[model samples]
Target: MPRARLHDVAEWTADGHRYRAELSAYLPRPALATGGPVLGTDVDLPSSWWADLREALAATAAVATTRTTVRQQWIDRHFTRLLGIPAPAIAWTTGHGDLHFANLTGPPLVICDWEGWGRIPVGFDAGLLHAYSLLRAGTAARIRRELAHVLDTPTGRAGELVALAQLLQVTARGGHPDLAPHLARHAERLTAMPVP
Candidate 1:
Protein backbone atom coordinates (compact mmCIF):
# COMPACT_ATOMS: atom_id res chain seq x y z
CA MET A 1 0.00 0.00 0.00
CA PRO A 2 2.55 2.55 -1.08
CA ARG A 3 0.05 5.31 -1.51
CA ALA A 4 1.05 8.92 -2.05
CA ARG A 5 -0.46 11.91 -0.31
CA LEU A 6 -2.90 13.94 -2.38
CA HIS A 7 -1.69 17.51 -2.34
CA ASP A 8 -4.37 19.13 -4.44
CA VAL A 9 -7.61 18.52 -6.33
CA ALA A 10 -9.61 20.43 -8.90
CA GLU A 11 -12.81 20.00 -10.86
CA TRP A 12 -14.32 21.75 -13.82
CA THR A 13 -16.94 21.52 -16.53
CA ALA A 14 -15.77 21.16 -20.08
CA ASP A 15 -18.28 21.30 -22.94
CA GLY A 16 -21.12 19.89 -20.86
CA HIS A 17 -18.89 17.27 -19.30
CA ARG A 18 -17.49 17.14 -15.81
CA TYR A 19 -13.76 16.65 -15.41
CA ARG A 20 -11.38 16.26 -12.51
CA ALA A 21 -7.66 16.39 -11.94
CA GLU A 22 -5.53 15.74 -8.90
CA LEU A 23 -1.92 16.30 -7.96
CA SER A 24 -0.39 13.68 -5.75
CA ALA A 25 3.02 12.59 -4.52
CA TYR A 26 4.98 10.58 -7.02
CA LEU A 27 5.87 6.90 -6.73
CA PRO A 28 9.39 6.12 -7.76
CA ARG A 29 8.97 2.41 -8.40
CA PRO A 30 7.82 1.13 -11.79
CA ALA A 31 4.92 -1.24 -12.15
CA LEU A 32 5.63 -4.96 -12.28
CA ALA A 33 4.06 -5.34 -15.67
CA THR A 34 3.60 -2.78 -18.46
CA GLY A 35 2.08 -4.79 -21.29
CA GLY A 36 -1.34 -5.57 -19.77
CA PRO A 37 -3.36 -6.79 -16.81
CA VAL A 38 -2.89 -10.45 -17.58
CA LEU A 39 0.62 -11.68 -16.92
CA GLY A 40 1.61 -13.84 -19.87
CA THR A 41 5.07 -14.64 -18.57
CA ASP A 42 6.72 -15.37 -15.24
CA VAL A 43 8.45 -12.60 -13.31
CA ASP A 44 11.17 -13.01 -10.77
CA LEU A 45 9.99 -11.63 -7.44
CA PRO A 46 11.58 -11.92 -4.05
CA SER A 47 9.95 -13.79 -1.19
CA SER A 48 9.75 -10.54 0.78
CA TRP A 49 7.61 -9.00 -1.95
CA TRP A 50 5.06 -11.74 -1.51
CA ALA A 51 4.96 -11.19 2.22
CA ASP A 52 4.53 -7.46 1.76
CA LEU A 53 1.66 -7.98 -0.68
CA ARG A 54 -0.12 -10.26 1.79
CA GLU A 55 0.25 -7.66 4.51
CA ALA A 56 -1.00 -4.87 2.26
CA LEU A 57 -4.07 -6.84 1.25
CA ALA A 58 -4.80 -7.67 4.86
CA ALA A 59 -4.45 -4.04 5.81
CA THR A 60 -6.79 -3.02 3.02
CA ALA A 61 -9.35 -5.57 4.09
CA ALA A 62 -9.46 -4.03 7.52
CA VAL A 63 -10.52 -0.63 6.23
CA ALA A 64 -14.18 0.39 6.49
CA THR A 65 -15.98 1.44 3.32
CA THR A 66 -19.48 1.61 1.87
CA ARG A 67 -18.33 1.05 -1.68
CA THR A 68 -18.80 -2.23 -3.50
CA THR A 69 -16.76 -3.76 -6.30
CA VAL A 70 -19.03 -6.68 -7.15
CA ARG A 71 -22.70 -6.67 -6.30
CA GLN A 72 -24.79 -9.58 -5.06
CA GLN A 73 -27.15 -9.33 -8.00
CA TRP A 74 -24.37 -9.84 -10.50
CA ILE A 75 -23.07 -12.72 -8.47
CA ASP A 76 -26.47 -14.37 -8.38
CA ARG A 77 -27.04 -13.93 -12.10
CA HIS A 78 -23.58 -14.87 -13.32
CA PHE A 79 -22.44 -17.43 -10.80
CA THR A 80 -24.66 -20.25 -11.95
CA ARG A 81 -24.96 -19.15 -15.55
CA LEU A 82 -21.30 -18.51 -16.21
CA LEU A 83 -19.69 -20.91 -13.76
CA GLY A 84 -22.25 -23.69 -14.16
CA ILE A 85 -22.57 -24.02 -10.40
CA PRO A 86 -24.80 -22.65 -7.71
CA ALA A 87 -23.36 -19.55 -6.11
CA PRO A 88 -22.00 -20.31 -2.71
CA ALA A 89 -22.32 -17.99 0.24
CA ILE A 90 -19.85 -15.20 -0.15
CA ALA A 91 -17.84 -13.70 2.70
CA TRP A 92 -17.25 -10.06 1.92
CA THR A 93 -14.25 -7.95 2.78
CA THR A 94 -12.52 -4.83 1.50
CA GLY A 95 -10.29 -5.58 -1.47
CA HIS A 96 -8.53 -4.13 -4.44
CA GLY A 97 -11.08 -5.19 -7.05
CA ASP A 98 -8.46 -5.08 -9.78
CA LEU A 99 -5.33 -6.80 -8.49
CA HIS A 100 -3.15 -7.74 -11.41
CA PHE A 101 0.58 -7.55 -12.00
CA ALA A 102 0.10 -4.28 -13.83
CA ASN A 103 -1.16 -2.58 -10.67
CA LEU A 104 1.65 -3.77 -8.45
CA THR A 105 5.31 -2.76 -8.12
CA GLY A 106 8.47 -3.60 -6.28
CA PRO A 107 10.76 -5.19 -3.76
CA PRO A 108 9.28 -2.19 -1.91
CA LEU A 109 5.79 -3.36 -2.93
CA VAL A 110 3.50 -0.56 -3.97
CA ILE A 111 -0.12 -1.17 -4.93
CA CYS A 112 -1.24 1.42 -7.45
CA ASP A 113 -4.68 2.30 -8.84
CA TRP A 114 -7.18 2.90 -6.08
CA GLU A 115 -10.39 3.60 -7.98
CA GLY A 116 -11.87 0.11 -7.67
CA TRP A 117 -11.08 -0.56 -4.04
CA GLY A 118 -14.17 -1.78 -2.20
CA ARG A 119 -16.03 -4.68 -0.64
CA ILE A 120 -15.62 -7.91 -2.58
CA PRO A 121 -15.74 -11.59 -1.90
CA VAL A 122 -13.07 -12.56 0.65
CA GLY A 123 -10.52 -13.92 -1.77
CA PHE A 124 -11.30 -11.73 -4.76
CA ASP A 125 -7.93 -10.04 -4.98
CA ALA A 126 -5.95 -13.25 -4.71
CA GLY A 127 -8.35 -14.95 -7.12
CA LEU A 128 -8.06 -12.09 -9.60
CA LEU A 129 -4.28 -12.25 -9.43
CA HIS A 130 -4.36 -16.01 -9.86
CA ALA A 131 -6.59 -15.61 -12.91
CA TYR A 132 -4.11 -13.17 -14.41
CA SER A 133 -1.26 -15.52 -13.67
CA LEU A 134 -2.93 -18.47 -15.41
CA LEU A 135 -0.74 -18.19 -18.47
CA ARG A 136 2.34 -18.89 -16.41
CA ALA A 137 2.03 -22.17 -14.53
CA GLY A 138 4.84 -21.45 -12.12
CA THR A 139 3.65 -17.98 -11.23
CA ALA A 140 0.08 -19.22 -10.96
CA ALA A 141 1.17 -21.97 -8.61
CA ARG A 142 3.18 -19.54 -6.56
CA ILE A 143 0.19 -17.27 -6.16
CA ARG A 144 -1.93 -20.15 -4.89
CA ARG A 145 0.76 -21.26 -2.54
CA GLU A 146 1.55 -17.82 -1.19
CA LEU A 147 -2.07 -16.82 -0.81
CA ALA A 148 -3.36 -20.14 0.40
CA HIS A 149 -4.98 -18.73 3.49
CA VAL A 150 -7.23 -16.57 1.36
CA LEU A 151 -7.70 -18.90 -1.62
CA ASP A 152 -8.33 -22.32 -0.08
CA THR A 153 -11.87 -21.98 1.16
CA PRO A 154 -15.40 -22.32 -0.24
CA THR A 155 -15.90 -18.58 -0.46
CA GLY A 156 -12.47 -18.29 -2.02
CA ARG A 157 -13.40 -20.82 -4.68
CA ALA A 158 -16.55 -18.85 -5.39
CA GLY A 159 -14.47 -15.71 -5.70
CA GLU A 160 -12.14 -17.45 -8.13
CA LEU A 161 -15.07 -18.65 -10.24
CA VAL A 162 -16.23 -15.07 -10.31
CA ALA A 163 -12.86 -13.99 -11.63
CA LEU A 164 -12.82 -16.77 -14.21
CA ALA A 165 -16.28 -15.81 -15.40
CA GLN A 166 -15.05 -12.26 -15.92
CA LEU A 167 -12.04 -13.38 -17.94
CA LEU A 168 -14.15 -15.83 -19.94
CA GLN A 169 -16.60 -13.08 -20.75
CA VAL A 170 -13.66 -11.05 -22.00
CA THR A 171 -12.82 -13.99 -24.22
CA ALA A 172 -16.39 -14.24 -25.51
CA ARG A 173 -16.00 -10.68 -26.71
CA GLY A 174 -12.96 -11.76 -28.82
CA GLY A 175 -10.38 -10.67 -26.30
CA HIS A 176 -7.47 -12.71 -24.95
CA PRO A 177 -7.85 -15.59 -27.38
CA ASP A 178 -4.66 -17.14 -26.12
CA LEU A 179 -5.94 -17.18 -22.54
CA ALA A 180 -9.41 -18.52 -23.25
CA PRO A 181 -8.73 -22.25 -23.19
CA HIS A 182 -6.73 -21.97 -20.02
CA LEU A 183 -9.54 -20.09 -18.32
CA ALA A 184 -12.04 -22.72 -19.49
CA ARG A 185 -9.94 -25.57 -18.16
CA HIS A 186 -9.46 -23.86 -14.83
CA ALA A 187 -13.21 -23.35 -14.59
CA GLU A 188 -13.74 -26.98 -15.42
CA ARG A 189 -11.33 -28.06 -12.72
CA LEU A 190 -13.04 -25.85 -10.18
CA THR A 191 -16.64 -26.84 -10.85
CA ALA A 192 -16.12 -30.23 -12.46
CA MET A 193 -18.23 -28.90 -15.32
CA PRO A 194 -17.01 -28.48 -18.87
CA VAL A 195 -16.55 -24.85 -19.89
CA PRO A 196 -16.06 -23.60 -23.41
Candidate 2:
Protein backbone atom coordinates (compact mmCIF):
# COMPACT_ATOMS: atom_id res chain seq x y z
CA MET A 1 0.00 0.00 0.00
CA PRO A 2 1.15 3.54 -0.76
CA ARG A 3 0.20 6.85 0.85
CA ALA A 4 0.27 10.38 -0.52
CA ARG A 5 3.29 11.84 1.27
CA LEU A 6 3.03 15.44 2.38
CA HIS A 7 5.80 17.54 0.90
CA ASP A 8 4.78 21.10 1.71
CA VAL A 9 2.33 23.12 3.79
CA ALA A 10 1.55 26.78 3.40
CA GLU A 11 -1.10 29.14 4.73
CA TRP A 12 -2.35 32.33 3.09
CA THR A 13 -5.32 34.68 3.22
CA ALA A 14 -7.34 35.28 0.09
CA ASP A 15 -10.54 37.32 -0.14
CA GLY A 16 -10.35 37.76 3.65
CA HIS A 17 -10.60 34.02 4.23
CA ARG A 18 -7.65 32.17 5.71
CA TYR A 19 -6.65 29.12 3.74
CA ARG A 20 -4.06 26.44 4.13
CA ALA A 21 -2.73 24.36 1.28
CA GLU A 22 -0.86 21.09 1.38
CA LEU A 23 1.24 19.68 -1.43
CA SER A 24 1.65 15.93 -1.42
CA ALA A 25 3.11 13.27 -3.63
CA TYR A 26 0.53 11.59 -5.84
CA LEU A 27 -0.43 7.93 -5.77
CA PRO A 28 -1.43 6.15 -8.95
CA ARG A 29 -4.72 4.86 -7.62
CA PRO A 30 -7.89 6.92 -7.84
CA ALA A 31 -10.43 6.82 -5.04
CA LEU A 32 -12.72 3.83 -4.88
CA ALA A 33 -15.50 3.62 -7.43
CA THR A 34 -18.14 3.87 -4.76
CA GLY A 35 -21.22 6.03 -5.34
CA GLY A 36 -21.10 8.49 -2.48
CA PRO A 37 -18.30 10.90 -1.88
CA VAL A 38 -17.82 9.96 1.76
CA LEU A 39 -19.44 6.57 2.20
CA GLY A 40 -19.40 3.51 0.02
CA THR A 41 -22.41 2.59 -2.02
CA ASP A 42 -23.61 -0.98 -2.34
CA VAL A 43 -21.07 -3.10 -4.15
CA ASP A 44 -20.29 -6.75 -4.36
CA LEU A 45 -16.77 -6.98 -3.04
CA PRO A 46 -14.84 -10.17 -3.41
CA SER A 47 -13.69 -12.01 -0.32
CA SER A 48 -10.14 -11.00 -1.12
CA TRP A 49 -11.07 -7.36 -0.71
CA TRP A 50 -12.10 -7.88 2.88
CA ALA A 51 -9.05 -10.05 3.51
CA ASP A 52 -6.82 -7.25 2.26
CA LEU A 53 -8.56 -4.80 4.58
CA ARG A 54 -8.15 -7.18 7.50
CA GLU A 55 -4.45 -7.44 6.77
CA ALA A 56 -4.12 -3.68 6.67
CA LEU A 57 -5.97 -3.25 9.95
CA ALA A 58 -3.77 -5.87 11.58
CA ALA A 59 -0.64 -4.09 10.39
CA THR A 60 -1.95 -0.67 11.39
CA ALA A 61 -2.91 -1.78 14.92
CA ALA A 62 0.76 -2.23 15.76
CA VAL A 63 1.62 1.41 15.18
CA ALA A 64 2.07 3.66 18.21
CA THR A 65 0.33 7.03 18.48
CA THR A 66 1.20 10.27 20.26
CA ARG A 67 -0.83 11.77 23.11
CA THR A 68 -2.42 14.26 20.73
CA THR A 69 -4.01 11.50 18.67
CA VAL A 70 -5.93 9.14 20.94
CA ARG A 71 -9.68 9.44 20.14
CA GLN A 72 -11.18 7.53 23.04
CA GLN A 73 -12.36 10.48 25.12
CA TRP A 74 -14.58 11.98 22.43
CA ILE A 75 -15.81 8.50 21.72
CA ASP A 76 -16.62 8.02 25.37
CA ARG A 77 -18.79 11.13 25.48
CA HIS A 78 -20.75 9.90 22.53
CA PHE A 79 -21.03 6.40 23.93
CA THR A 80 -22.10 7.53 27.36
CA ARG A 81 -24.75 9.91 26.02
CA LEU A 82 -26.26 7.00 24.15
CA LEU A 83 -25.25 3.73 25.74
CA GLY A 84 -24.86 3.33 29.48
CA ILE A 85 -21.54 4.41 30.91
CA PRO A 86 -18.97 2.61 28.78
CA ALA A 87 -16.96 -0.33 30.01
CA PRO A 88 -13.87 0.70 31.92
CA ALA A 89 -10.46 0.70 30.26
CA ILE A 90 -11.55 0.11 26.70
CA ALA A 91 -8.60 -0.86 24.51
CA TRP A 92 -7.29 1.36 21.74
CA THR A 93 -5.56 0.69 18.41
CA THR A 94 -3.92 2.67 15.64
CA GLY A 95 -5.81 2.89 12.36
CA HIS A 96 -7.29 5.35 9.92
CA GLY A 97 -9.75 7.49 11.87
CA ASP A 98 -11.86 7.71 8.72
CA LEU A 99 -12.25 4.29 7.12
CA HIS A 100 -15.20 5.10 4.88
CA PHE A 101 -15.20 3.87 1.31
CA ALA A 102 -14.16 7.22 -0.12
CA ASN A 103 -10.82 6.99 1.65
CA LEU A 104 -10.01 3.51 0.40
CA THR A 105 -9.06 2.16 -3.03
CA GLY A 106 -9.74 -1.30 -4.18
CA PRO A 107 -8.80 -4.36 -6.28
CA PRO A 108 -5.36 -3.95 -4.73
CA LEU A 109 -6.67 -2.52 -1.43
CA VAL A 110 -5.01 0.79 -0.57
CA ILE A 111 -6.22 2.90 2.40
CA CYS A 112 -5.62 6.60 2.01
CA ASP A 113 -5.97 9.89 3.88
CA TRP A 114 -3.26 9.50 6.49
CA GLU A 115 -3.73 12.83 8.27
CA GLY A 116 -6.88 11.40 9.85
CA TRP A 117 -5.09 8.32 11.10
CA GLY A 118 -4.63 7.90 14.84
CA ARG A 119 -5.29 5.69 17.80
CA ILE A 120 -8.98 4.74 17.79
CA PRO A 121 -11.30 2.36 19.57
CA VAL A 122 -9.97 -1.18 18.95
CA GLY A 123 -12.74 -2.17 16.56
CA PHE A 124 -13.72 1.35 15.61
CA ASP A 125 -12.25 1.38 12.14
CA ALA A 126 -13.93 -1.85 11.14
CA GLY A 127 -17.12 -0.75 12.87
CA LEU A 128 -17.04 2.53 11.02
CA LEU A 129 -16.65 0.70 7.76
CA HIS A 130 -19.50 -1.60 8.68
CA ALA A 131 -21.64 1.35 9.68
CA TYR A 132 -21.10 2.94 6.31
CA SER A 133 -22.18 -0.26 4.70
CA LEU A 134 -25.52 -0.21 6.50
CA LEU A 135 -27.30 1.17 3.44
CA ARG A 136 -26.80 -2.21 1.88
CA ALA A 137 -27.53 -5.13 4.12
CA GLY A 138 -25.40 -7.57 2.14
CA THR A 139 -22.33 -5.41 2.28
CA ALA A 140 -22.91 -4.80 5.97
CA ALA A 141 -23.29 -8.52 6.56
CA ARG A 142 -20.05 -9.17 4.75
CA ILE A 143 -18.27 -6.69 6.96
CA ARG A 144 -19.71 -8.40 10.02
CA ARG A 145 -18.63 -11.80 8.75
CA GLU A 146 -15.13 -10.67 7.89
CA LEU A 147 -14.71 -8.68 11.08
CA ALA A 148 -16.74 -10.86 13.42
CA HIS A 149 -13.76 -11.61 15.63
CA VAL A 150 -13.15 -7.93 16.23
CA LEU A 151 -16.73 -6.65 16.38
CA ASP A 152 -17.86 -9.39 18.74
CA THR A 153 -15.36 -8.79 21.52
CA PRO A 154 -16.10 -6.51 24.46
CA THR A 155 -13.57 -4.02 23.23
CA GLY A 156 -14.84 -4.41 19.72
CA ARG A 157 -18.37 -3.76 20.92
CA ALA A 158 -17.11 -0.53 22.39
CA GLY A 159 -15.63 0.27 19.03
CA GLU A 160 -18.92 -0.45 17.36
CA LEU A 161 -20.64 1.64 20.01
CA VAL A 162 -18.49 4.59 19.15
CA ALA A 163 -19.22 4.14 15.49
CA LEU A 164 -22.94 3.90 16.10
CA ALA A 165 -23.07 6.80 18.50
CA GLN A 166 -21.01 9.01 16.25
CA LEU A 167 -23.13 8.16 13.27
CA LEU A 168 -26.26 8.99 15.24
CA GLN A 169 -24.72 12.30 16.22
CA VAL A 170 -24.09 13.05 12.58
CA THR A 171 -27.64 12.16 11.67
CA ALA A 172 -28.90 14.47 14.36
CA ARG A 173 -27.05 17.27 12.63
CA GLY A 174 -28.99 16.56 9.39
CA GLY A 175 -26.70 14.03 7.83
CA HIS A 176 -27.52 10.52 6.70
CA PRO A 177 -31.17 10.67 7.65
CA ASP A 178 -31.75 7.39 5.89
CA LEU A 179 -29.14 5.83 8.08
CA ALA A 180 -30.24 7.39 11.35
CA PRO A 181 -32.72 4.72 12.32
CA HIS A 182 -30.40 1.92 11.32
CA LEU A 183 -27.62 3.41 13.39
CA ALA A 184 -29.89 3.74 16.41
CA ARG A 185 -31.13 0.17 16.13
CA HIS A 186 -27.62 -1.19 15.90
CA ALA A 187 -26.50 0.94 18.81
CA GLU A 188 -29.27 -0.47 20.96
CA ARG A 189 -28.48 -3.99 19.87
CA LEU A 190 -24.72 -3.79 20.34
CA THR A 191 -24.54 -1.70 23.49
CA ALA A 192 -27.63 -3.27 25.00
CA MET A 193 -28.20 0.14 26.46
CA PRO A 194 -31.34 1.17 24.54
CA VAL A 195 -31.01 4.11 22.19
CA PRO A 196 -33.40 6.98 22.77
Candidate 3:
Protein backbone atom coordinates (compact mmCIF):
# COMPACT_ATOMS: atom_id res chain seq x y z
CA MET A 1 0.00 0.00 0.00
CA PRO A 2 1.39 3.38 -1.02
CA ARG A 3 1.60 5.82 1.88
CA ALA A 4 3.02 9.20 2.80
CA ARG A 5 6.76 8.71 2.39
CA LEU A 6 8.99 9.84 5.24
CA HIS A 7 12.00 11.97 4.27
CA ASP A 8 13.60 13.28 7.43
CA VAL A 9 13.24 13.46 11.21
CA ALA A 10 14.88 15.86 13.65
CA GLU A 11 14.51 16.86 17.28
CA TRP A 12 15.58 20.03 19.05
CA THR A 13 14.83 22.11 22.11
CA ALA A 14 14.13 25.83 22.20
CA ASP A 15 14.38 27.67 25.48
CA GLY A 16 11.83 25.95 27.72
CA HIS A 17 10.13 23.83 25.09
CA ARG A 18 11.24 20.68 23.32
CA TYR A 19 10.17 19.82 19.78
CA ARG A 20 10.40 16.94 17.33
CA ALA A 21 9.46 17.04 13.69
CA GLU A 22 9.33 14.79 10.67
CA LEU A 23 8.80 15.53 7.00
CA SER A 24 6.86 13.10 4.87
CA ALA A 25 5.52 13.26 1.37
CA TYR A 26 1.90 14.37 1.28
CA LEU A 27 -1.02 12.43 -0.06
CA PRO A 28 -3.33 14.02 -2.60
CA ARG A 29 -6.31 12.88 -0.59
CA PRO A 30 -7.73 14.64 2.39
CA ALA A 31 -7.58 13.19 5.87
CA LEU A 32 -10.32 10.74 6.85
CA ALA A 33 -13.69 11.96 5.66
CA THR A 34 -14.81 11.45 9.27
CA GLY A 35 -15.06 14.96 10.67
CA GLY A 36 -11.65 15.74 12.20
CA PRO A 37 -9.40 15.07 15.15
CA VAL A 38 -10.79 13.07 18.07
CA LEU A 39 -14.39 14.03 17.51
CA GLY A 40 -16.96 11.34 16.83
CA THR A 41 -18.44 11.26 13.35
CA ASP A 42 -21.20 9.15 11.84
CA VAL A 43 -19.48 8.42 8.58
CA ASP A 44 -21.69 6.55 6.11
CA LEU A 45 -19.26 4.30 4.34
CA PRO A 46 -20.36 2.05 1.49
CA SER A 47 -20.21 -1.74 1.44
CA SER A 48 -17.35 -1.52 -1.03
CA TRP A 49 -15.44 0.61 1.44
CA TRP A 50 -16.04 -1.95 4.15
CA ALA A 51 -14.89 -4.70 1.79
CA ASP A 52 -11.69 -2.83 1.06
CA LEU A 53 -11.03 -2.36 4.75
CA ARG A 54 -11.60 -6.05 5.37
CA GLU A 55 -9.19 -6.90 2.58
CA ALA A 56 -6.61 -4.56 3.95
CA LEU A 57 -7.03 -6.03 7.40
CA ALA A 58 -6.59 -9.50 5.97
CA ALA A 59 -3.34 -8.33 4.44
CA THR A 60 -2.35 -6.87 7.77
CA ALA A 61 -2.95 -10.27 9.36
CA ALA A 62 -0.33 -11.78 7.10
CA VAL A 63 2.46 -9.72 8.61
CA ALA A 64 4.16 -10.37 11.96
CA THR A 65 5.00 -7.53 14.33
CA THR A 66 7.59 -7.75 17.09
CA ARG A 67 6.28 -4.68 18.81
CA THR A 68 3.93 -5.38 21.68
CA THR A 69 2.33 -1.99 21.97
CA VAL A 70 0.80 -2.77 25.36
CA ARG A 71 2.33 -5.09 27.88
CA GLN A 72 0.29 -8.00 29.28
CA GLN A 73 0.59 -6.94 32.91
CA TRP A 74 -0.71 -3.47 32.20
CA ILE A 75 -3.56 -4.87 30.18
CA ASP A 76 -4.46 -7.42 32.81
CA ARG A 77 -4.29 -4.86 35.61
CA HIS A 78 -6.71 -2.46 33.95
CA PHE A 79 -8.85 -5.28 32.66
CA THR A 80 -9.76 -6.16 36.24
CA ARG A 81 -12.05 -3.14 36.16
CA LEU A 82 -13.86 -4.59 33.17
CA LEU A 83 -13.47 -8.35 33.33
CA GLY A 84 -12.63 -8.47 37.03
CA ILE A 85 -10.20 -11.31 36.43
CA PRO A 86 -7.90 -10.05 33.77
CA ALA A 87 -8.41 -10.47 30.02
CA PRO A 88 -9.93 -13.75 28.97
CA ALA A 89 -7.98 -16.22 26.91
CA ILE A 90 -8.14 -15.10 23.29
CA ALA A 91 -6.42 -15.57 19.96
CA TRP A 92 -3.77 -13.14 18.78
CA THR A 93 -2.94 -11.63 15.43
CA THR A 94 -1.15 -8.81 13.71
CA GLY A 95 -3.12 -5.56 13.70
CA HIS A 96 -2.90 -1.88 12.95
CA GLY A 97 -2.86 -1.40 16.77
CA ASP A 98 -4.48 2.01 16.29
CA LEU A 99 -7.47 1.52 14.02
CA HIS A 100 -9.49 4.58 14.87
CA PHE A 101 -11.09 6.92 12.34
CA ALA A 102 -8.19 9.36 12.37
CA ASN A 103 -5.86 6.68 11.06
CA LEU A 104 -8.18 5.65 8.28
CA THR A 105 -9.10 7.42 5.03
CA GLY A 106 -12.21 7.04 2.95
CA PRO A 107 -13.14 6.75 -0.79
CA PRO A 108 -9.86 5.00 -1.64
CA LEU A 109 -9.59 3.68 1.95
CA VAL A 110 -5.93 4.37 2.58
CA ILE A 111 -4.73 3.69 6.14
CA CYS A 112 -2.01 5.93 7.60
CA ASP A 113 0.08 6.09 10.74
CA TRP A 114 1.80 2.76 10.98
CA GLU A 115 3.98 3.49 13.97
CA GLY A 116 1.60 1.68 16.32
CA TRP A 117 1.14 -1.27 14.05
CA GLY A 118 1.83 -4.49 15.94
CA ARG A 119 0.51 -7.75 17.24
CA ILE A 120 -2.67 -7.56 19.26
CA PRO A 121 -5.25 -9.96 20.58
CA VAL A 122 -7.35 -11.49 17.87
CA GLY A 123 -10.14 -9.08 16.93
CA PHE A 124 -8.22 -6.28 18.64
CA ASP A 125 -8.16 -4.11 15.51
CA ALA A 126 -11.92 -4.34 15.08
CA GLY A 127 -12.40 -3.91 18.81
CA LEU A 128 -10.28 -0.76 18.87
CA LEU A 129 -12.16 0.59 15.88
CA HIS A 130 -15.43 -0.08 17.65
CA ALA A 131 -14.13 1.51 20.83
CA TYR A 132 -13.40 4.74 18.94
CA SER A 133 -16.90 4.71 17.44
CA LEU A 134 -18.66 4.65 20.80
CA LEU A 135 -19.63 8.33 20.69
CA ARG A 136 -21.33 7.81 17.36
CA ALA A 137 -23.80 5.06 18.06
CA GLY A 138 -24.60 4.48 14.43
CA THR A 139 -20.98 4.18 13.40
CA ALA A 140 -20.32 1.93 16.36
CA ALA A 141 -23.24 -0.27 15.42
CA ARG A 142 -22.06 -0.42 11.84
CA ILE A 143 -18.66 -1.54 13.00
CA ARG A 144 -20.18 -4.32 15.08
CA ARG A 145 -22.37 -5.42 12.22
CA GLU A 146 -19.52 -5.35 9.76
CA LEU A 147 -17.15 -7.24 12.03
CA ALA A 148 -19.60 -9.47 13.85
CA HIS A 149 -17.55 -12.47 12.94
CA VAL A 150 -14.83 -11.11 15.16
CA LEU A 151 -16.79 -9.05 17.68
CA ASP A 152 -19.41 -11.68 18.48
CA THR A 153 -17.30 -14.40 20.04
CA PRO A 154 -16.13 -15.12 23.57
CA THR A 155 -12.55 -14.56 22.48
CA GLY A 156 -13.59 -11.56 20.44
CA ARG A 157 -15.43 -10.11 23.42
CA ALA A 158 -12.27 -10.60 25.47
CA GLY A 159 -10.34 -8.68 22.87
CA GLU A 160 -12.91 -5.89 23.15
CA LEU A 161 -12.62 -5.96 26.93
CA VAL A 162 -8.92 -5.29 26.64
CA ALA A 163 -9.49 -2.54 24.13
CA LEU A 164 -12.06 -0.85 26.34
CA ALA A 165 -9.78 -1.16 29.34
CA GLN A 166 -7.03 0.55 27.38
CA LEU A 167 -9.42 3.32 26.44
CA LEU A 168 -10.51 3.72 30.03
CA GLN A 169 -6.87 3.93 31.09
CA VAL A 170 -6.45 6.74 28.58
CA THR A 171 -9.51 8.40 30.02
CA ALA A 172 -7.99 8.23 33.46
CA ARG A 173 -4.94 10.10 32.19
CA GLY A 174 -7.32 12.88 30.97
CA GLY A 175 -8.93 12.13 27.66
CA HIS A 176 -12.42 11.69 26.31
CA PRO A 177 -14.17 12.37 29.62
CA ASP A 178 -17.50 12.10 27.83
CA LEU A 179 -16.59 8.57 26.86
CA ALA A 180 -15.93 7.26 30.36
CA PRO A 181 -19.47 6.45 31.42
CA HIS A 182 -20.30 4.89 28.09
CA LEU A 183 -17.19 2.75 28.20
CA ALA A 184 -17.97 1.64 31.71
CA ARG A 185 -21.54 0.76 30.86
CA HIS A 186 -20.47 -1.22 27.81
CA ALA A 187 -17.82 -3.00 29.83
CA GLU A 188 -20.37 -4.05 32.40
CA ARG A 189 -22.73 -5.24 29.71
CA LEU A 190 -19.99 -7.31 28.15
CA THR A 191 -18.73 -8.98 31.30
CA ALA A 192 -21.45 -8.34 33.86
CA MET A 193 -18.42 -7.86 36.05
CA PRO A 194 -18.43 -5.57 39.05
CA VAL A 195 -16.26 -2.50 38.66
CA PRO A 196 -14.08 -1.40 41.50
- Order candidates by lDDT, high to low: 1, 3, 2
lDDT of 1 by residue, 1-196 (tens): 6666678889999999988777777988778878888886787899999999999999999999999998889888777777777888888999999999999888688887776789998888998899888899999999999999988988887788888887788888899788888889989998899874
Give lDDT tens digits, candidate 2, residues 54-133: 88898888888773344656765666776555544668888787887777776667777766678787888888888887
**lDDT by residue for model 3 (15-117), tens:** 9897877777776776563543343668888998898888888888788778776567777566776446655776777888888888777777888777667
lDDT of each: 0.86, 0.75, 0.77
TM-score of each predicted structure versus truth: 0.90, 0.82, 0.83
List the candidate 2 regions with Cα displacement exceeding 4 Å. Answer: 2-22, 25-29, 33-40, 67-70, 84-88
Scored by lDDT, the top model is 1
Candidate 2 has an lDDT of 0.75
**Residue pairs in steric clash, candidate 3?**
none
Q: Which is superior by TM-score, 1 or 2?
A: 1
